[model samples]
Target: MAARGGGGMTASTRLAYQYVVLRCVPRVDREEFLNVGVVVYCQSADYLEVAWEVDRDRLAALDPGLDLDQVCEALTFVEGVCAGDERGGAAGAKPPGQRFGFLKAPRSTVLQPGPVHGGVTTDPARQLDHLLSKLVT
Candidate 1:
């Protein structure tokens, strides 16, 4: 079957399963972009890891003086998402790193947030909803 990410498949069936993706940041020429890690991993193991590719191109476009390795490291959370392999908490928690990125790691475990990144962990709680509403839509 054709891969979702559209490339060589990962060596895991867990990746082949059907997964949902919530894309953010519309693409340049295409439709939209997948910036969140949890959504990317939960979608499929492969996706050719399109987000990584998108990120690479974006970093180059941004010209932020970032190296390829650094770019990959920043996306490590994606891998962690796969490892966690749990139903993303819904209704409440924090930003869902599953699709969104950036989370304050806890001492006992890596805290998983709800669907929308950047919350109290980021700015004053009041502004989080406003920012996410604009960003997600």
Candidate 2:
């Protein structure tokens, strides 16, 4: 994606992006998890995106009795967080960077955020979609 800048240089403005993998832990005691979703935030471009993969087979392999509906609901909630929807709680009221920080913060729960990673992109939206396809799906 070619982004035009003031100086007529192609792709001169590279946006900064941060992202985290959302994981599901069927059993907290066992310390096991599965990558179920991703949240990507690009502040310079004012872009925030999320993507998720639903693999019942893999989930069941981890825990045959897993309540898939609950797990999916949690994943959806994570998306809501990224979108600043009503489901995001007070975190929704914050700015994009703060919201990203809230989502990327480490927590011990069924739906936990993985490590935070950074990247530079000429087009944040395209990079977001690319990451969703490569990481989530």
Q: What local distance difference test score does each model get?
A: 0.31, 0.75
Taking the candidates one at a time, how many backbone clashes does each contain?
6, 0
Residue runs of model 1 more than 4 Å from their true location after superposition: 1-52, 85-137
Estimate, for each residue in 5-90, the C-alpha lDDT of model 1 and write its tens digit.
32334333322222222332322344334433223222222221212223456544544443546434434544334333232233
lDDT of 2 at 90: 81
Expressed as tens digits, the lDDT of each residue in 2-107 for candidate 2 is 1212223247687677888888888889988888877778776676666777788888898899898888887777666667778777887778788888888888
In angstroms, give how far residue 119 of model 1 lies from its true place. Answer: 20
**How many backbone clashes can be found in candidate 1?**
6
Identify the runs in model 2 with alpha carbons over 4 angstroms from their true place. Answer: 1-12
lDDT of 2 at 40: 76
RMSD of 2: 4.8
True-vs-predicted CA distance for residue 25, candidate 1, Å: 12
